[model samples]
Target: MEDENNLAVLICGAGAAGLTLAIDLARRGVPFRLIEKMDSPFPGSRGKGMQPRTQEVFEDLGIIDRVVAAGGTYPRMREYQSDGTHTEKDIAERDDPTPAEPYHIALMIPQFLTEELMRERLAELGHRVEFGYELVGFEQDEQSVTSRLIGPAGEEFVQSRYLIGADGGRSFVRGALGVNFPGKTLGVRAMVADAALTGLDREVWHQFNNGNMERMLSICPLAGTDLFQIQAVIPLEGEVDLSDEGIMGMIRERCARHDVKVQSVTWASAYSMNARLADRYRIGRVLLVGDAAHIHPPTGGQGLNTSVQDAYNLGWKLAAVLGGAPDHLLDSYESERRPVAEAMLGLAAGLLDAAKRGEMRRGRELRQLDIGYTESPLTLNRPGRWGPLLAGDRAPDAPLRGAAGSFRRLFDLFTGSHWTLVGFEAERNITSGRKGLHIHRVGPGCELQDMAGHFRNAYGLTPGEWVLVRPDGYVAAMVTPDETSILQMFFSEVGLTDADGLRH
Candidate 1:
């Protein structure tokens, strides 16, 4: 009951997480097929918040404008304390004077809108979502993976060198691989609803009313319609069931005191959050992403943001490896992202447990905390201040100008091929030697003013800050304006060659 075809990658699921990975890889010309079990995308504004970091990633994918058109900006946050109202610190605005990477505030976009934009963009690259195709079974060998999918078209078997399971929390891929998603599913329950109401200041979040626990409410504004991500604790005594009337009664009572009424309700769900991370990202030829890799409480508002970042980190690595980089390059995906996931999971647990114990104020301590890892193997040469960059770690963004064109970032143009080299030295300073590296000159096609402006104003590129950007956009290595260390980095990571092989 199945047809078969050999594809490069057969990605499972088509939600925001799945679609994001697919679009990034497809754009790089890596052949892949996306499979979804549902007849269509999951309904409801399920996760209705986008952190600023995600807004930047959305920009890289070329869909931030559409996401903006679909959702409004984040409403002002109101922080509270027992003594009095405390002024919330502006964490979004990083005071550091860096011209590159401009997004400092989170964008509020609906989950469905995010997925649709990514899907449409992927279509622009000529890949369509394979809807209703569910993965019923899969088998992997030393060379490849074979998956069985069932849908409206019946059964089809897919063959590929690698597989990704972007399927959600109850992921079939995780189950199939026998990987342990070990962690704690705590007994903290809350009710979230999407509904229409009036008389409430819909834009700003309202927290702690008249010193009553039952009166607490959190409301988020979405873009396209009169939709809000409304949340309140479940009020029933003795191990509560998050039933409809129980949830609605809590909402009605909180709103009633304020003279606000919910005239219509769209959707509601109740679940106690679980904090967990997978023991591994790759089980031979299959890898896990998003909720499939890790799950956490929604306290920090990091769930969607972390998953999308995971896909971005993995997408380019997969493209480069499939395009013929060493398989060891793929190993760094788990090494880089897993620790970040581990950090987030621990952070989520801390915030969630702190809230339940009613030690409410300490939850904000994360903003002022100076976190570092003397222990993370992925940490680069400068470990304390540069936890985000390590061996095989993602390079921070910088504005690169060249004859090829003026780009808002170094990551933008490098998305096309394996490696991008930016240097302040003349073309004569560039070199091709024994190891194997690709070098493109930075002059001729583009203007010097625009290029110089991007470097001086956008990135703090001194004569010595000549940066070496990898194919995947991580800073391979940094040195003073010496062509020796810079070109050596390219040769060590990428080969110095054309189609004819290694250049002299």
Candidate 2:
């Protein structure tokens, strides 16, 4: 039996990224310890936007219903001019959900509430975060990572196969590893607060600005709650007060409306925007994820969403390695995610510039549905066999009909921690009774029937074609009936075989 105290992974930080990885590992039966330095959960309403891709991840994690119930769509932007004139416009162009993309709009829920929901789900999986445990330092070897923790009970030493730093931008783990985070601070300070206020409409996002970044103020209603999130840009030089009275004063001066009053401020903070990415993602057995690996401005609402996806991409790979896969499999996490972080950093910086110019135009890119791994080492694409979707692209969802005439969807089949091989009108039986692999056939007389032709239309598939999807919902490989051997070869390259299964 495995030692209960010895963990497969030791995760530091209890933010969305850390909690996400913990939940994934817990459901997979991977032993892990999630620790947070703070004594309690975060109380701020920062990072409140959930992109479409993140919504899809929430569905697989089994919290989509609750998340959707607790969230609301981005409201119309109500801008207040200096002459007391106001205009209303949509914050982002809304898209309806189709048969292919089930979630087409961004959902708005405060960060604290999202974390609370995830914590509840983690408890259901028989695990809970270890709060007030601070990771002071650690060292790694070829076999294991030994970490030192400072908690209420004093100091303790623990060992795990790997250590992941989901800690924020000033990450202690990254500093200990001496990683270089090269970027510039934008030299603009912004104050953000969550408070209960009177006299402000709750249906739209209220903005008071004079076409200057340093003179912008926004009060937006927080969905599923009785409060508003207030944000204001402070001057570059000088100290800005964060008290309730100071915040109210700033709001009154900017909007020229004394009727709006802040009753109370629950949480507040002042922060300077910066864009940075770690030069490397891993060193030996210690790795970085989320804000520890990259930090950027909050202009595009991509910070939290991107961090959550980072953890999602790394969770399965870490579990695979701990279950006796090659260590090189862990290397692919950085190779795949680092470039994405870099690209998103550039995008967020560009959006910040746009926001300063009062041109906050949000498009499909902000939804993050187009991110993929077409250039990863793990992806395999057969030459001259490309369709609308290719290897390393996100697998689109489609409606299906079950053998018993029950309604089904592709996401329902890809919900668990298993590899899915979907054969579309294939001749031979590709069903493998492997422990961690699931095979489904979609055709006229198969177990799953695409009677509406949604699958064929979404995947652009002809007869005798098969698509293998990875655990994280990306197309791993595409093959024809004659190229069935490619599936076995692909599995072998990823360190999985039929004899050993995916995990021992």
User: Each prediction's Cα lDDT score?
Assistant: 0.64, 0.88
Show the colliding residue pairs in model 1: 71-223, 395-474, 403-445, 403-446, 418-471, 436-495, 436-496, 437-495, 437-496, 464-481
Q: What is the alpha-carbon lDDT for the whole of candidate 1?
A: 0.64
* Residue-level lDDT for 443 in candidate 1: 37
Error of 1 at 147 (Å): 0.6
Q: Can you write out model 2's per-residue Cα lDDT over 392-499, one digit (the tens) per residue? A: 889999999999989999999999888888889876665456557788999877899997898998888888888888888998888787776667766755645574
Worst 10 residues of 2 by lDDT: 495-504
TM-score of each: 0.81, 0.97
lDDT of 1 by residue, 245-320 (tens): 5545665565544455566667777777788899999988899999899998877666777788788778877875
Write down the RMSD of candidate 2 (Cα, Å): 1.7
